[model samples]
Target: MLRTVSYHPVVRALAAHGLHTTVDVSRTYPQRRFTDERDRQYAIAAVRALFGDPAGREENGRFHCLHYESRPESR
Candidate 1:
């Protein structure tokens, strides 16, 4: 079980201040260890809420990754 604070909105606020922001989220355990699909979805949603859409996603045998970057021009 993972819990995230509502500070996700701060990412945009930092970008508004002309600061570049990057976030990387990776699973701590193997995919098979996460037996609950809802947990996977929740993790994805939490990261998305904090950083907006992911710039990239990758999954290998070991773990999954979600990458996010906020560029001033993109915003």
Candidate 2:
């Protein structure tokens, strides 16, 4: 399951106090469509809404796991 720390500053700060911060929005378990950009956005937004922005955190930022991509034949 793809996981990461919560985005909320408060939540993240409180994590040391025995709070749960790991979010599991893996497409495989939830049966989500990773192919659709909208779906991917939704998943990311959901994380932000539930937690908060982790961009301010050190060594942390948004990322995507695109194993491969296809280019147009003409290109």
lDDT of each: 0.47, 0.40
lDDT of 1 by residue, 1-75 (tens): 122234447777976789677665553222333346665566556646655432333112122433456777654
Clashes of each: 0, 3
Candidate 2's C-alpha runs over 4 A off are: 1-33, 52-75
lDDT for 70 in candidate 1 is: 71
Q: Output the lDDT of residue 74, model 1.
A: 55
- TM-scores of all candidate predictions against the true structure: 0.30, 0.27
Candidate 1 residue spans exceeding 4 A from truth? 1-3, 27-75
Best prediction by TM-score: 1
TM-score for candidate 1: 0.30
Model 1 global lDDT (CA atoms, 0 to 1): 0.47
